[model samples]
Target: MACIDTLLAAFAEVAVDPDAQLEKHLAAGKRVVGVGPYHVPEELVHAAGAVPFGVWGCVGSSVEAKKYFPPFYCSLCQMTLEMGLTGTLDKLSGMMITGLCDTLRAFSQNWKAGMGSKVPMIYVTNAQNRFIEAGRRYTVEAYAEVKRRVEECCDALVTDEALARSIKLYNEWRATMREFVALAGQHPAEVSVSARSSVINAGYYMDKAEHMSMVQELNAALAAAPVSLSGYKPIVLSGIYEDIPAITAILEENGFAIVADDMAKESRAFSRQVPETGDPLEALADGWCALRADTELFDPRKEHIEQVVELAKDNAAAGVVILLAKFCDPEEFEAPLVKKALGKAGIPAVTIEVDQSTESYEQARTQLETFADLLG
Candidate 1:
């Protein structure tokens, strides 16, 4: 396998200027809003004539985040909090906070107190659990609340037709993303690993139609590109944390490509919407149900295993890689169960635990090389 140093040096060269990318849209008289990990019906934001950027946190910048929130908060939340405190999110016209976890719920209140004048805050509850009727009802109420919040903050009436059109636009964007996934699954190098990951991440920054168009052009270019050599095995990247480039860099360098993934930020989410009806609220709820349903039921255990097995078999992934954060309790508890299942399925797997403030990219490279060796 290739050494980790060469890989890290190469990754440094393949950077994306996220700050510059954010500036481009902001200068065009567009408002940028932030959303966290829980699945957001971005259609509502789009219909309201604002741009919804999924704030996944800066991988190397979480040290600055610890000042506002406790270090115990997940890196994802910390990075976002740091960004808000530093006024990096000053360009944002507003921000939506998902009540996905305790940290985020606290984040909503802290952010409002700190940056409410510059960026408005909307708190949303997710419809992630299916068995609980109260869960579904809470989601519906939250959707309505989000709609109301956005409408009031933006000072605009959110009509049903606008929301439905927004849904159609986002749906197309989702289809475009799937096209990339299908291509990568079948032909990894036809599109460079980082390029594929970047396209998916780009969805958060631009309008749905514009983003979809960019992917289509990228897809056409990839389709016409030369085929990647075979004999390199496949791997399914799992666990709670993976930035697109981080996963792509490890896989491509080690001669193993990520054919599929179960990472919440990358693969598990897709376009979910409520139907276009006179009641925008109900339609929003219905859309969320369908979107989550597409990912499988809300049971964490079932969903995690299903993703690992399906990706492994369908893409012929040789092993699974759990790209987890060091102090993440939820993923830490679930790791053994997932590890055992992958073992029973005859797929070799490994874990690489990284903290939000992790400074050792070299360590990540080393662990990934070990994973590649295990697969061999």
Candidate 2:
């Protein structure tokens, strides 16, 4: 129990304070590359002998970023730009920006204009038609370009051997994370809602291999411990991101436990692993193309809605909660469809608007309390 609490605390600390992690790596003379949302090929950065630091934007107001974006911009992009503009991320050696959504595409341009001089930006454009052969080829080429840029930024050669090693390491990390997620679900009494989120969020800041070791230990501990008997209501959480303590606290206060999630920042990020027995770059491309049920990605058949339904059913969830990021058009467009699909499947769901700037969660607390009663 002591070990479990210590590990959880460590993860939560790193999750909430990414700057400390960045400075720790920098102090060790490591080159850190900031990676933006969705996917941006972190294997290449690892292969180039640099750390791939996730830049998901912190929980804060975006005052400086207002000059670049309108009031309707998503807080993820706004806060990320705010950090860069305020020189909070200036210590990063480079930044990798993926244009997965309209807001992110615009953010790429705004970041280059605002902070290009302080930290170099690598704009990565993924092929949306990724199921086709031509699309796979295009993705490979794009990743190759990313590799080249990463090499240039780190002043090192990204050899195929190194890339293959990095791919293997990342796959191992993903598998370990999946195991940890399952363990957390099975023992919600031991792993609180916020603690489960922090464990996953910490992966964004720490090195993959290092994070995996800690998670593996935690997983073993959870597996050995007795199953939780707490009267927590298990549910599936679908969102772009939901690491906000205020929001998660409300869920826990309302007796909710996130047993499964379609959140892009948590389960979605590790749902697919890079195939290890192929050309390293091609494997990376294939992995990225294979990612499913994500709002930022293209889904012509609206399969993402069914995917959410299936996720909830598979986990035996009492309901589904959609943590809708305010001003995020992709999630906004899909929320109704997901809710409709859940309704068709006879699953209860609630959508709550969330943003980084909001300090008050009273409305969310009330909504969730009502949802909890409905679930009961």
Candidate 3:
């Protein structure tokens, strides 16, 4: 097994420099498709002989994107557009955008208008009512269209064999990630807050198989190492994204160890596995339909509230920290209910408003410090 520090450094390097990773793949003559936020069919891209590069917004100000979006729009969508407009994503062979929420729905239109033909845009619409027979059929057909578009864009065939292989690889990757999260929680001192985020975030910019191998090694290293007795305050995090180094730094300074999370960028992306048997497209659709407790998905029962409470209790977390992304309507709408549920369950929780452009984290530090005190 590789040294834990060495593995962590590798992940941190890749996590912070996804552009370099994209360039590296481009230099290798590999077709790269940019996948936007939420549940996207990355397996199709892999089967189509291309890299599925994540296009989650970066930490930066949105200048050019302002013309396309209002000030009230979420920074995540805005910065993503800014990257495309600034030619930062010019090298991408194609871009796949999902209409999971209102902001993302508008983002797709803006990306089409702004990027034009410089990069191909494949728009995907997911059915919110995903558990019914109609919804399942819709998912399969929608994903089939995505497969067709991906094949056309990559100039390669998404044959059943290739798709099946990709599905198996992704399922294995997901299972490995779930293992890593549990291991990381067991040894938080070895995996610092920022380090834990880096390891998971790195997967967004890397080949699933490659990232999984490194994580498997890291998991082994962590398992062999002595358990953490640091007595840090364990907490569960819920958010659209929580990979920001500054935010993690605050949690680390406040002596918080994230044992589990509902972050879309982390566990939410890998909490469920794709079915390995039967039709690959239907399997992918079933995987998406299986997703629960996410703000993007339709949950009329407000099950996410109880889910957060259960996660905190299950992990023995003293509290829950919500990294509320600014101007994200779905998360904003769901935050109150989650807080209420946690309160009823006797789980201490705090919400920190997060934005991509904000350089200052002093407010977050203060809030987290208070939260830490409360937990104590």
Candidate 4:
């Protein structure tokens, strides 16, 4: 329990400090690359020898960013641009954003104009048609350009060997995280909902190998701990983001435990590891194709819904919560279909809105409490 507590504390420290890694990299005179949500080829950033700091945006409303887009845009984009304009991202040598959705597509341009040569912005379009050969080729080329941009920013090259090593390291970390999530599920009493977020979110702010060592030890600790059969409702969470403060606590307050999640910021990012063989970038491209269909990408077969269903059934979840990021159009469109599928299957479910600067969880607590009672 002591070791587990230490690990959780360390991870929580990193997760709570938004600019810790960036400051460290700056102090060391190392180039830091800022990466926005959805899809970013972080391997390319690592291969270029720059730190890849996740930019989920600041947790407050941004009056400056309002100038670029309508008020309807999600807070993630709005606040990230706010940070960029407000000089919060001045330490980063470059930033990467994907055109995965309409808001992100527009954000990339707004960022370039706002920064105006202060920080270079790399633009990438994730191949939605990734199920096909042409799509794979297009993604590879897009990654190649990302590689070039990062290399230029760092004044270094993403060599094939370095890229291959980065891929291997990332896969190793992903495997360790996979082990942690599985163990966390079996010992929900110890993990707690916030502890789960700590263990997962902390990795984004540290070097992969460092994060791996910490998590590997925590996984071992969890494996050695006693299991509990508590009267908490277990559920699978599917959504664009899980960085909202107090979300896990709100669920725990309602006698619920998050056993698993399909959150883009969490498990979805590492659902499949890149294959170690062949070209590293190519392997990464293949790995993208293998990812479970989610709101960001096109799922011609609608396997994403089935993936959600399978997660709940396999985890024996009491229900599934589709935590939609507010004003996110793709996730908004998927809500009804998600509800319909789970409804037909006789699965308990709820859709909750989450934002970074959530001042209150009262409404969410009520919804989850109602769901828990219905399941009971």
Per-prediction TM-score: 0.86, 0.97, 0.98, 0.96
lDDT of 2 by residue, 82-185 (tens): 99999888888899999888889999999999996689988798998887889889999998888888888889999889999999999899899988988898
Tens digit per residue, CA lDDT, model 3, 278-332: 9888999998888877777899887888899999999999999999999998899
Cα lDDT tens digits, model 4, 104-180, are: 98889999888887889988877888888998999988888888888888889999999999989988988898888
Checking candidate 3 for backbone clashes, the offending pairs are none
Q: Give the clashing residue pairs of candidate 2, or none.
A: none
Deviation (Å) of 303 in candidate 1: 3.3
Candidate 3: lDDT of 258? 85
Better of 2 and 4 by TM-score: 2
Give a tens-digit lDDT track for model 1, residues 1-376. 2232333233233335656667777788776677766676667777888777777777666645565677667777777777877877877767887766566677778777777677788877776674467766877888888888887766676778888788767667777777767666556655456655665666666556866765676666556656564767677777655664555577679987777777676666653434555566666676666543222235554566655776788877888888776656567767787788888888888888766566656777898898888777
Find the 10 residues in a row with the least total lDDT in model 1: 2-11
In terms of TM-score, how similar is model 1 to the real structure?
Answer: 0.86
Clashes of each: 3, 0, 0, 0
Better of 3 and 4 by lDDT: 3
In candidate 1, how many Å is residue 357 off?
2.1
Off by over 4 Å in 4: none
What's the lDDT for residue 125 in model 2? Answer: 85
